[model samples]
Target: MKYGSTSAPIQLARGQAMSSVKPWRPDEPAATIHAEGAWLQGAFISKIFYGIIIVLSWQCLSLLWRQTTRSNYKTKMSFLAIVFAIFSFSTLHSGYDMKAIQLGFVENRNFPGGPSAYATLSRSDTPGNIACILMQWLCDALLIWRFVMIYRGCVAPMWLLAATPITVYLGSIVIGILFTIKKLTSGSGVRRT
Candidate 1:
């Protein structure tokens, strides 16, 4: 054989290399879990994770305002009180504990199957699921109190008075319930598809 000539072995090796380095094929089918139509599993937690910091910052500012303004102490304190209460609840509900639950580091005993069984199959866990559920319930109660106060304080538009707090409380309740149910039924194990 002529040493410099193109030969079958070189051609076969080149063919093998090309096949081994084949590009990804878009036509390949993909599989994913429906996850019971839950939206909060991924997107929701990420949003809330970032939002906790902002809520805590607001709480800090409200506290500082109350401390610095002596002449308007009553007004500042009142505003700060409301802000602090809300922020405290928000922080507790949105804090890292919730994230840990979501991430599945802390097992959710509330799940239907035994913790080990569920854990064996789950992919992700939201850490603060418990805190969020409790917080939403608390928010509902607070909204009722606020609604009553607003009604007694002034003759505001009926629509505005009815809509704002009701929407917030109800929305939170719905979200919390949905997340709780999802967590309970989804099993205890973590698996990635």
Candidate 2:
């Protein structure tokens, strides 16, 4: 067998030879296969983490539901609503991700740029992305609300103290909206040709 020089040693400007530093070649089939394997591994890991989160969220939901009664009903109901919203969005996001993964790896495995590239590059999962954005906003707003409630009277010039989170919250909303609009109008986030 002839061992051709498919990968020759590269000489650097610093009088050094790099014979082992392989450059990334996305067009290569081997590289695409490697990327697909890496993406699948990451997806599996995410599923595991999502499973853990589901268990924790279920536990929290049950505890909160058990605590709700006629007394303090209003406050408990508000907390329950926030928690339920978070859970719903998280579930929706996970479901979307799973669907995208299946479509990219199974249904469209021969898509133009390969399955990994198609899965990673496509912004077709806009619903999932938006759900993630909304979930984050909800969590952040909840935190800000808690902060304000705890320090409403303890801090003088409460407005100044609370301004940071409020401003940040609003800024995030604007950014998230802009991002969603851009994604929606950008046409499929991948190239077919």
Candidate 3:
């Protein structure tokens, strides 16, 4: 072994001598693997989100079902139960798609499209993204309804306060529509070598 040889290839930059190569890799992976990379593929986190939504819906329904002693509130209570269940089911459907992508696409093909295909909104999972937006819209509408219930009428202040969220809700819907259109327009990713 040559000790302290000047021919050891020291790098020179801007008339200054520099030694050692800069590291081309991080000290650690960008994301720490949790539950065996489940988080990266979105399977673990999606399941947890679904579980939390289910638990909260179940609790709300339990309370509603137990307290309904009148026919008027009966319809309202049933409506809530239905809406919550529908939204929760929609969320679960998205999670199901995530799991399928993780298993069938990523793991099966050895992550051919990389991890981005598994997590981000792809061509197939567009409906899942729409469902999430719809659910969020419904939740916001329900909150506005709660305020209406409290004010006993659609007063000016209530409407004034609702302007911002309603505008945001509409904006999100427009964005979702635009995204869907863009996705459809950019179809057929198949390539020939």
Runs in model 3 lying further than 4 Å from the true structure: 1-42, 85-88, 103-113, 117-122, 151-156, 189-193
Candidate 2: the clashing residue pairs are none
Give stretches of model 1 more than 4 Å off.
1-49, 52-127, 153-193
Task: Give lDDT tens digits, candidate 2, residues 1-193.
Answer: 2366433333232334344655433455786678788988988897887787788778888998899899988988898888888888888888888878887877777787787667656775779989989998999999999999999888478898899999999999999999999877764576432
Cα error, candidate 3, residue 60 (Å): 1.2
Give lDDT per model, in order.
0.57, 0.80, 0.60
Report the C-alpha lDDT of model 1 over 1-52, residue by residue, as the tens digit. 6877778767777777768564433222232123312333654675665487
Clashes of 2: 0
Clashes of 1: 24
Q: Please name the candidate that would achieve the greatest TM-score relative to the true structure.
A: 2
TM-score (C-alpha, index-matched) for candidate 1: 0.39
Q: Could you arrange the candidates by lDDT from highest to lowest?
A: 2, 3, 1
Better of 1 and 3 by lDDT: 3
> Candidate 1, which ten residues in sequence have the lowest lDDT sum?
28-37
